[model samples]
Target: MYDWSALPRGARASLSVAGLVMAASFLGFGALVRSLEVGLLPGLATTVFIWALPGQVVALDMLASGANLLAMALAVTLTAVRLLPMVVLVMSKVRLEGARRWPLYALSHFVAVTIWRIAEDGIDEVDRPQRLPWLTGLGLALMSSMLVMTSIGYHLAQSLPPLLAACLVFLTPSFFFISLFANAKFRMDYIAIAAGALIGPLCHQYYPEFDLLAGGLIGCTIAYLIGRAGRKRSK
Candidate 1:
């Protein structure tokens, strides 16, 4: 049995605006799954296993379109590749000097965009020894909330209006942009964000198959080069 009083600081911190936003986002995902006619169990299973929203969405869409297993797997894998850098960043933040490797491996499963954002913003406040626990707690709380909200959304999808459901689906990316703007400390960060915003839609229009990967890579590369030159000029 879990001890409620002994919840980690990270978990406690997550029970705030961040947690609420994540729940709201997953509620839309659940509705999307239902609207696609996927069973609730499979939708919930994606939450448990795939965890990443983009990957789950891709898998659901492919399944709805009757894509073969190999194609669906390839597409989901490609979408999930974006999470690798996030996992590396989060691992660097929370890993202790001599911590066990197994736990870090386990924790990597929870390093989605929302959890990554939470850790990036606040994990430093936790003691080094407790950082892992804090992250674990935060992950669990967010995951639990996602599961519950998803179940609720799935059941309520039939009654939800089209506009409202679409708005709900937009909440996560909207929060992502808001948080990026809010927490940006470097010019490069702003540049990357702006570049991505401008380039993403254009890429989607012309090269829909590779829009996300192409836009992000090009935008960040441009930002890095500009930022580097600026630093050199200042020196």
Candidate 2:
């Protein structure tokens, strides 16, 4: 029973910003699938279903390498494990108490980095009754635009220069880093970012396959322990 007649100005603004960033990022992703030789249907499926650029990239890489479907699935699943906590945290903040949980479960599919970050930063401006709609609108806007962009990228992949196409794919990471720096508000944020940045490269140099998952878990664990120790000292 949420209001749907008119969107708040804040929600509209949030949706616009998020939509633009996501569209730009996914435009590159779409081009990537084309370059990777993954068909447009599979590419669109990944964008609509996976909705995780990193995971989608990994899937594309694994597919290119001729990895078996089962193996690729497992790898992508592992890469996506980080989203679990993000979904839980956001849902906790925005869901109405006593509401049916089914819709929340469906909405969790939209809890990728862009939606999570946008919702985290802007949900405060949205009334509780309107929060879900705001997120849904933002996510759908990004998804639909991304679908079109992916097709464009796929077709342009052949005519585009290698360097230029690669640059296009770089948009997501750039946006992610910018958002990370902008939205970070806690000491733990800095610690986690620093730890992950340092550890991730080292892990990539050593173990390319497991690097992302391992680095994320190790970095976050270190950040949590440090924060806990600091809290104890303060007390």
Best by lDDT: 1
lDDT of 2 at 189: 79
Q: Provide the TM-score for each candidate, comma-separated.
A: 0.73, 0.75
Model 1: number of backbone collisions: 0
Give the candidate number with the greatest TM-score: 2
Off by over 4 Å in 2: 4-15, 176-235
Q: Write the per-residue lDDT of candidate 2 for residues 69-112, one digit (tens) a residue.
A: 77687779977987998898889777888776776887788888
For candidate 2, the lDDT comes to 0.76
When summed lDDT is taken over every stretch of 10 residues in candidate 2, the lowest stretch is 5-14
How far does residue 56 in candidate 2 sit from its true spot (Å)? Answer: 1.1
